[model samples]
Target: MFDLIIRNGKLYDGTENPWTRLDIGIVSGKIANIGDLGHEQARIEIDAQGLAVAPGFIDTHVHSDLLCTKPEIHKIKVLQGVTTELLGQDGISVAPVSELTKPLWQKQLKGLNGDIGEWPWHSIDEYLKFLDKSNLAGNVVYLVPHGNIRTLVMGFAGRKATRNEMQQMRELVEEGMRQGAVGVSSGLIYPPNVFADKEELIEICKGAAKYDGCFVVHIRNESHRSLEALDEVIDVARQSGVCLHVSHFKVAGQINRDKYEKALAKMDAGRAEGIEITFDQYPYTAGSTVFHAILPPWMHSGGTSEMLERLKDPVIRQKVKEDFQSNLDYENWVLNCGWENIIIASVSTEKNKRLEGKNVLQLAEIKGVEPADAAFDLLLEENAGVTMVVHWGNEQDVIYGMKHPLQIVSSDGIFGGKPHPRLYGTYPRVLGRFVREKKALTLEQAIRKMSGAPAQLLRLKDRGFLREGYWADIVVFDPDTVLDRSTYEDPLQEPAGIHYVLVNGELTVKDGEYLGTTAGQVIRRKT
Candidate 1:
């Protein structure tokens, strides 16, 4: 007898191959058998006659570290059939934080990570323990946040690291790895992390290399200096002998749309020299982050409080606006893409709630102020606690990114209010729009990127493939009819055609409805 059985399904096997009719039996949450069993008995059996049975999807890039604090909103992910989420993205998260500095870091990260609720642990192991106490919608794997490490040693200072500071940073990373961080993540485009030089990055990556971990980077720039940033990451990988994975890889701005091939060619050249590199991209043309990211790196120095004070000065704010306006030669999102292309996604205060769906340009025109001034004032009012959807990615880039052999799928999903549609639509949209409709890729290839690819990247020996003896994390969906219903207007709408989902042999969603189960556990590094 088996705990559960799925019969008559077209199995993709999490690889680039045509589907084959197969029977999968689950016993004790691991795949126990994978052949036709005459007169097999089970407590529950699902007749997936026409559905595609594949490994549960893995979202490689996400900002769920802080948002996971709000469990009620996790249904958006469950409905999309995401069985695992790579948390602690962009080098920002809630572990390894000093209790003394945790309050400040939490305040500064509100725009990017949303609010950090009652889950407060200052060390990586403690954070994991806190997660274990709660039921999650999906499994979560963690990266040692580089920003948190930097802040622990330097407190958001904007400069090169001193020798002593460098040593301390390395020890912190080593400690995190000892506590089971799979790798270290860097957001070179963001503060504190941006302060470190290549040598400093190499040192931390070396710590990760000790455990056979990869260096996942949100590269420094994806616009004017995208190539330069790629080269820097490549150089770090080569020098430190660490594997590299780029997060949310994309070129931004209208003028930079054509740079994707060149950016990719640079990575290919590095790969030819024997450096292992992979990148993850969402299926959407627009990306979301804190609206405060529009400011130049220096403006963010001295922490969030200081930045707010600077924005209060009319002369300083005007100079900042002028600087952005005159810098169209680079990937300044607002300057190159215009404020109208940036839609406010959320705000922390009730006074700004009405602006969530509107663009800064619209708000500016209504308030009788320049768009830049309006943006600064809003950030000042909200204490920089704002998020936005920036429509800077080109459609051609998104398509080619999906087609790249080295590219994998991730949602980079953010949740709160009027969130990016990717939060609800990524996996289904890939199956529906890319595979079934446009034929950009075969269904097999799409499944490969979402399942096996990320599973391998994260080094999970027991998940990401529907094989005997592997954890029974699986999804059954009507490939032909699976569709992402979420749109830019109704960003919170649930998806369609996901018939069933299971995590660790437990049903989380059945018959297209969530069962409100939290069967997920913390995924740790094998070493």
Candidate 2:
């Protein structure tokens, strides 16, 4: 007998094809059949009348590295119909830390990944095994973080790696791929990663390429220098022969808005030149990340503790302000988008929690200090654990990226107090705003970006399609009413219209509520 049967639903099948009226049968955690299924009998049956049944969404970028261990609190992903998440993004994550560097990463990543007290694993294999033991809400995949590999070989050093050190980092990358990482990820604007030269990146990409793994990167700059940064990564892809996926691709700042078409053309040209290129972006103009990322890369050279110490030094603070005024080489968020456009999103301490949603300008007034000093003090007070949402681009630009044939959807969501609405709203917002309202993408095309496209990019074998003989990871939602309710101010709200979700043929969400079933598995790259 079939384990379950979903009836009377229109299936999109994740192939960018037209939806067809069909029923699906699931058995032993796999899709057994897809057709009329009227004569099928099952242990359980779901009447999905008037619902769109498709492959469960795969979030291509997420910071759920530490949060995945707590399935109860991590249900936000599944509630939005995400059945699998690609973690270890932005080149910094929990695993592959040495006893010495563990504390450093813990401190550095607290704002982005959260402080989960003590981490249990220190290697890629151990971390994956830990996820296997945890009660995960959805399937999890990983990319070997470039920062972790670099810190393992050299502890957050600001200088370029020596040849021997580069070899060591490459070896670590190979070890991670052998242990099942599907790719390698780096956040070039973030420190340690920022210190890496292009040659180092090419070497690292070669390691991932050896395993047929993709190279996912948050490029060095997303504003005025965006074109150059794009060229740099494209060159890395050309040299290493790795598939390249840019994370949260955008041309930020009003000054650089004109570069949007140019950036897309650059990507097109790269693809035409035989370099595989794809990108994932949240359907929003505002970008979110740790607030400390605003500082010049040199200040973050010694790690979080040392950076925090430097923040207290008047000389160093003056130097930082000077760089903010003079430096056009780095991302320099505060310079591109004014301090008023950068709003604090999260903080660790109770005293600073009140500052969560306030911009640095408001924070300056409240603290009776200059905007720069107010931000600097907050970073010190929070021990460098501060996150922010920077209003960086326009809605039209977001739509432009969405319509690109090579683009896929990803939340790029980071969670904490006053998190970006994208964390809770990304998938539904696309279905509602972009598809239903704006007409930027059709319903079928949207589903393909969120589902099949990401799955293909990550090389997931069987989870991204509603096909017979595939795993039964599915989402059933009301197309007419599907919409995201979360907003920047009230970011904790869940989405509407997602009624049923299944992971590995097990029902995890029923009637728009989580069923508390931990049916997720750790999906490792096939070596």
Candidate 3:
């Protein structure tokens, strides 16, 4: 007998094709059938009348690596219909680190992933195994982060890799890929990773390419040099012959709003030359990151401890202030340092909980200091790591970019205290706010962007579509009722209208309630 049968649901294939009613049969953790199974007996049945059924959402970018270690995060994410989450995004994760460098990597990344307890330093496979033991509700796939690999081979010493060091970095990539990394990801704007020269990246990509893996990057800069960063990414793909995926692709500063056309032209040019390139973007205009990252990358060198020490020196602080002014527009400064834009999204330091919803600007004013100075002081007081929501991107740019066929939507999601609303709201906002409500895209097109498009881009073998013999990772929702309720001011609210979510033929969320089951697995590259 089949394990379950979801009958009478309007199946959306996440393609341009029209929707149709179908009955899905599941057994042995795989799809047993997708057509009429009128006589088929099953242990359980769900009559999804008047509901829309599609493949579970695949989040192309997520910082849920640490959250996957907690059982409750699955309650939030699985109920939102995400079946697969890509971890180690934006060049930060815990894998591939040796015992000595482990603490530094964990502390540096805590802003995004949240602080974790002491863990052993092991291979990439062991890290994945640890996550599996946590029993979260969604399948997870990770990119072997280049930053961690760099720290593993070379300490936080700010220098280019020598020939021997490059080989060691390469061997690490090869080993991680063999241990089941989906690909390699790097953040050129983030330190240590910012230390990576072109030769180092090319070498790492070469190793990842050997496994037919793709490289995803958060380009070096999103300001005046955004186009140049685009070109650099394209060149990496061309030279290494590995597929490239750009993360949170956007032009941040006001001056760069008009530069996206040029960015598009660059990607098109590369594609014309047979280079493989694609990109993902969040739906909002405000970008989120650790407040310390906004400092001059040089000041952040040698890791958080070094940075905190430097913050105490007046000379060093003066130099960093000058660097910030030079990087930002003095005449028309569009910074998010104040309370209007700088909300404390998450604070691992227990004493700072009161700052959670307040903007940094408001906090700065109360302290009778400049926002920049307040930002500097807070970082040091918080151990040089505090997450901030920066109002950076242009709304016009965000809307225009989402309309592109090549631009898939992602959350850049984090499950933390007063977190960015994108974690809970991105998918529904794309469907309810963007497509149905705003008319930015039709229903079919939005589904394609969220489901089949990303799955095809990552070349996930059988997921992201509604078909026979595919894994039964699916979501059932009411199209008219679906909407994201989370807002910038109150970021902790859940979304509305999603009724059920299944991972590998088991329901993690059923009838709008979390079932507390952890059927999720680690999906590895099939070599």
Ranking of all predicted structures according to TM-score, beginning with the best and ending with the worst: 2, 1, 3
lDDT of 2: 0.93
TM-score of each: 0.98, 0.99, 0.96
The sequence of per-residue lDDT tens digits that candidate 3 reaches over residues 245-326 is: 9999888666677788889778878888998788899999887777677776677678888988988898988877676656
Per-model C-alpha RMSD: 1.4, 0.8, 2.1
lDDT of 2 by residue, 228-322 (tens): 99999999999999999999999989999999899999999999999999999999889999999999999888888888989989999999999
Candidate 1 segments whose C-alpha is farther than 4 A from its true place: 328-331
Model 3 ranges with Cα > 4 A deviation = 328-340
TM-score for candidate 1: 0.98
On TM-score, the stronger of 1 and 3 is 1
Off by over 4 Å in 2: none
In order, candidate lDDTs are 0.86, 0.93, 0.81
Clash pairs, model 2 backbone: none
Which pairs of residues collide in candidate 3?
338-361, 339-359, 339-361, 339-362
Please report the candidate that would top TM-score against the real structure.
Answer: 2
For model 2, what is the error of residue 360's alpha carbon versus the real structure, in angstroms, after optimal superposition? Answer: 0.6
